[model samples]
Target chain A: MAGTNGTIISVNKVRKSYYRDTIEIPVLNNISINVPEGEFLALMGPSGSGKTTLLNLIAGIDRPDEGEVVVGGVNIAALSESELSKWRARHVGFVFQFYNLLPVLTAYENVELPLLLTNLSKKEKHEHVEFALKLVGLSDRMYNKPGQLSGGQEQRVAIARAVVTDPTILVADEPTGDLDKVSAAEIMELLDRLNKEYKKTIVMVTHDPRAAEKAHTVRHLEKGELT
Target chain B: MKIPLKYTFRNLQSRRLTTALTILGITLVVFVFAAVLMMAHGVEKTLVATGSEENILISRKASNGEISSIIDGETVNIILAMNQVARTPAGAPFATKDVATVINLPKTDYVGITNVTVRGVSPDAFALRPMVKIVEGRAFQWGAREIIIGNSIARRILNARVGGTIKIGGDQWTIVGRFDAEGCGFDSEIWGDVLQLTDALGRSNAFSTLTLKLRSPQEFDSFKEAFESDARLQQFVPKTERQFFEEQSETMALFIRVLGIFITVIFSAGAVIGAMITMYGAVANRTVEIGTLRALGFRRRSVLSAYLIESLMIALIGGIVGVVLASFLQFFSISTINFDSFAEIEFSFALSTGIIISSLMFAVVMGFVGGFLPAFRAARLNIVSALRAS
Candidate 1:
């Protein structure tokens, strides 16, 4: 399943629109982009450039008004809601800008949540959670809650959670947007390790020049058109 | 659906004030609901526990209880002569003429006048009623203006203690003693000589009713025919004492049940709304957490069940508290008007396992009904939008 030439994401001219009190506000206008498996890609854009909209479409979180989004070679819009959920659990891992870790759970439990979807034994799941935490360089802080961890530590926990299921693609939205320079450098370093060492296909959306510098290929998105 | 319990609990803890207020509302509703059920059951217990399953009560046709029936002293003797009647070792029939009356007695604890029953009976009355026993002072003297008050009379009503004298019709009747009848309805009365009570109340020719213990249940028809065949009487009813007491409870039981359901419905509605408000706030506060769960690949059904489980936990807490508080009331006494008898009746809060179980079931149902919509909202949240909430 680890391949450098296979396309993990394929979008066929997808379009998205929003409505503000019956006024159709177009967001992603006739866009198509794809990242192969194990390829690290960055989406760089200004505000209101439809970069997040395209990310949402690729992650199976939103449906396109026209055309189709196929992730991991499965057309998501064609799948039922429950099927899409199962696909998301198995095919995609997600990391967000703010490191949206549930504040109640310890970092270990946060990492263990996605693993619960797999049919792994409890002992095996524990092993995977431990490895994911260790991979993110926060194995010692596994017992700490998100609130107890610093911004960088919280993002690392989020990363651990995203990778626990060993998914084909990692969809990250400004993964270092809230971190300081040192923490941002640490996070980019962790994503770099995930891409190079684990052969992860990371698709990150960011306005940060440094974050984009870490990606193997950086593309500019302006007014829903990719360049 | 696998729901992590820690998420729900932490969300509840973060909104401590709302959760506490919601639980308090549920407690109040459950308390009122249980109290009404207890009172209703207490009414049924008041009647059902006092009557014997095998005894026969002879009265004029169509009459209800001893209060509305009248029989002569000569008829009392003749009915005592029937061979179908059970007897003691002294060769006397197991029957007695019970003269029952009610007089207004001022309540010691409240401002209203409560009617206390006064029963005049013969010495064999004690022998006929095996459940009757003197828990306190001795029996009343025969053919004298001396009365023994029932235990309820002594404790709740004024001027009922032994050795106390009270005037009736300008003559002071001495309270020579007090007694109990093993918690039967007789315990609510004052007992004295039939002749003296008839003479004092100036209804000298009438004894209110007679109770006869049959040799067996087979003699009931013959006994009824014998009374109805008497040419001089026409209006009294002859029934098994058990049936008569059961008839007396129907109206009171219906009244209590209706009242209980009414209060519970009104209060439970408000509690359900309160639970809705609390659950809505819980869902709102945990948007990011929910988003995290969704992004971690949890199904929508899991989030729905998690919120519902949290609401049920609150309701269960309130229900247990209400039941515990109601159990404490087993030691207190309550008196209310019995609709069948049209007289004041004393009762205790009757506790049964059914009442407690039903109360808990009711509260848990409220939690589900109230929490379902809000939990659905959480489940249907947009993952990207939810994660972006500041």
Candidate 2:
């Protein structure tokens, strides 16, 4: 995984587990992978196959039990919790399976959330938020709450939030899992354009082969191991 | 970066019922806190206003109040002859011998009987206290069994109005007039000639206390010293009238304050628990939102502060409402027993700037205690677990 020159994310022998009542249940075991800059990669697996756990590791949302997870040339596993959060704010953007948009916020405010951590002035932040919403073709619905939007529109707003900060890597964990086929296809197309047009490095975890087909390369995970 | 303050406000608005119920609980606690403070302040104000700084009050050395003190006419004569005592325009010493006695009277509300103070005073009593005005009818005549009732007693006790008759021991005295004492404790007493009252109460040749007006307030120290150093007056103690009334209010005010704080502590505990439950429910419902915030690089402290601010806003609203409700109490006068004197005293609720500030601070403390654990729980939530919950 380290040999690649342009790799944006390098996973070296990563292992993760869940503990219940002091008993360990392994999720990801001895996994290694590399994602090059601007590459659209999808991780495919069945339920309980550890694909989501691996995605969380890559996104810096969770630490691995044992391994080095390097993203944008930084070993996130060695970073403290607060340091990892700062690193995530600067480098990684996430899109969740359920389109996790805060119901209290409108589309524009949801996208503006990540940029609040930046030192950008209010005028600059407004411009960035408007551009991100327009990119997702939801500029007209900028002020609409998540409840007021359709499923596809809500997913688009979540995507806008993911890319609003122009992060170094974008991680989507089953981004289309909760949408209908047409809405899911629209979301997949949006992710495709975000990759080819914006040259964003993307790591997507999905069980749908049609969603996987939109990515440049697809890797399979089975029984907590990469295959 | 921090979550915007509106986020906290909007979340509280989202759960209107829970927010309202929590605010209501806090409101009740604040109300009790402020109302009790007002009562204590009222008692102090009423008693403190009863005395003039320039006058001296003489009572038995160990007496708790004028009602329990006995000053014989010999001591009164000695006090009046002192050069420190002021002379009136007619060249008479501006002094009066007074007696205090508590008599049981039925309440105007038809409740059980309560004790009322009947004060015996000389003709010079009115000259010494210029604030006492006869508001209705004529003043009681000297050496007659006629009495002047204070405005408060006339309104609050049965058969205490002007022109009414009140039975004292075996004699019936006429209430010839109603006097207003300008909101002081004297407004709760009935006044008549000292000799007549002593005869009617079967306590002849003895006076409860002697009040003397000084030419200047600075004369108080010399006046007190003159009486204390006199071998004939050694059984009595003398103090500035202000000091005497202040001592009278001390025990009752302290009792009300301690009782109020005790009740407030108990009520605040329940209110804090109510706020805690409401905040916990908010955390449980917004698990994903919190995770999203954490994942967005807002620190755990930010999440904790957001919820804390939310709870503080609830308590603040309740405090305002409670203070507003307590202010209405100023319109009604209530009576309670003075523990030291064993007499009913009437006073209106008094709101002060200190009471307002302290009550609001108390509400904030309740919010802090209630919100702390829940906010910490929200802050320590595992990002992955929280995101996965919804």
Candidate 3:
């Protein structure tokens, strides 16, 4: 169910914290933001500014300490751990800074990882995996393992894995942090195309200014507060 | 969703050295476990196969074995006259009064001497035991100063082969034949005429045991009752030959099994620890991979089962290799002293289905114990913290 205001995600007064051996460390203050459908949003912050923390809460990878994180009209903060995992599998796709591809699997297998949780038949999974890889412009490198691929190709494979399930939301954390300027530009262009052409809603965390230029909206965080 | 088996398998294959070493540890422990069981089973089988169920052995009431039992000629005659005794074709009673004693003999390979059983038998003893076949030479004549050696004794004892002379009880006896007792306890003995042996030992008109063939195996109860109830035969005890021989092996077999299992338990501990260390290393190295799997929506249960399956596969491989290694032990014979008779008996290790199942189960248990903690740790990892690991 879409929000009445055409929002796909609604975070209300979300707060999060980290603890180190009984020492409470506040990471995110009472920050709230709403993302409209098919919107590409970038979150920028200095180190320890809680920008990635906010992205994680919105992506359903972490629960907010004192707020409701409603994605696609479901209160994900109220879901049990196992229920949250199933929900994440059905709705969220992730692209991490390190590519996070299993080294033993080929690019094709890596892309098919998320679909293993689905009830899809082998043929259906193959079709989805092929389309995702082709969408990321890496269909030719699908048979190569991570060790055999370039850093850019590995991140492209990660993106293919992210979209193979046709998830409701795409979340990227430092997607260009490990790539060269040329490869980083290519990745940002792919994200921009996914948003504008494929109508995918994307939330990204990055320190790269040029990467933020591709998003529809940009938010900044200082300390634990949004500015 | 369940984790793919190929994922688990490839992880094992990725660390070849650790996997091989852990498997080797399990294999060694399983081999020892199987070999011990085989040894104990072999001793019981060899002794149990020595007796025929239809035959009854009469010994002194309080004696341990034929070596210590004594039955006079008059009592043997009285027992042979009973109707329960079987008859030969010539209508004579199928009974034999045999004398058994132990003599020190030099072993062919070992430096020290070992006790060898020497039995003095009646002429009809061969007719009673059909399993004793002459494999290499002719049977000894009844009245001659000749003897027959069992195949095991002929092979292991110095100068005990056919066409050789052995001095026993101050009398010279020529070895005339070699008989195979189908790997029974009899294969560890030497047989000769009872009269000549009794004369040589100066125990005239007395024998050590009276062995009789019953008219039918079912007549054992009545025969034992009749023999024990007779006033003249009251000092003698009768037991089915099978029961007596089986009892002969119980103590030694039990000892072997208990001692072997104790040692196996100690060795398996080391093997379990080796498996644990290897599994811990795997979990430590794959922390990020586990997080990726969890983030992809694989349940914690799936992760636990994947690690356990990996460990089980390693142990199963080890079990197979160990069983194959233990199977080869059947070709080599070992000799040990039968505590009841104080004579050395030779038998080969025997593998059975029960031992194989036991050994494999033991290995699986080790795998389960070793893999549990590491798998639990992997499953309990916090998704956010795990993903943050480099």
Please report the candidate that would top TM-score against the real structure: 2
Rank order (by TM-score, best first): 2, 3, 1
Correct interface contacts retained, every candidate: 0.55, 0.69, 0.65
Docking class of 3: medium
lDDT per residue as tens, model 2, B203-223: 898999999887777877777
- Over the stretch B241-291, how does candidate 3's per-residue lDDT look in tens digits? 888888888888999999999999999999999999999999889999998
Q: Residue B200 deviation, candidate 2, in Å?
A: 2.6
Of the pair 1 and 3, which is ahead by TM-score? 3
Candidate 1 docking DockQ: 0.61
TM-score of each: 0.92, 0.96, 0.94
Candidate 1 residue-wise lDDT, B162-220, digit = tens? 89876664568898887877666667777888878888988886888887788888988
How far in Å is the alpha carbon of B240 misplaced in model 2? 2.8
Per-candidate local distance difference test: 0.82, 0.91, 0.91
The ten-residue window of minimal lDDT in model 3 chain A covers A55-64
Over 4 Å off in model 1, which ranges? A1-5, B58-61, B70-84, B167-171, B182-184, B216-243
| Residues A1-227, model 2: lDDT tens digits | 22359888999999999999999999998999989999999999889999999999998989998989998788999999888889888888899988889898899999999998899999999999999999999999999999999999999999999998999989999999999999999999999999999999899999899999999999999999989
RMSD in Å for model 1: 2.8
Clashing pairs in 2: none
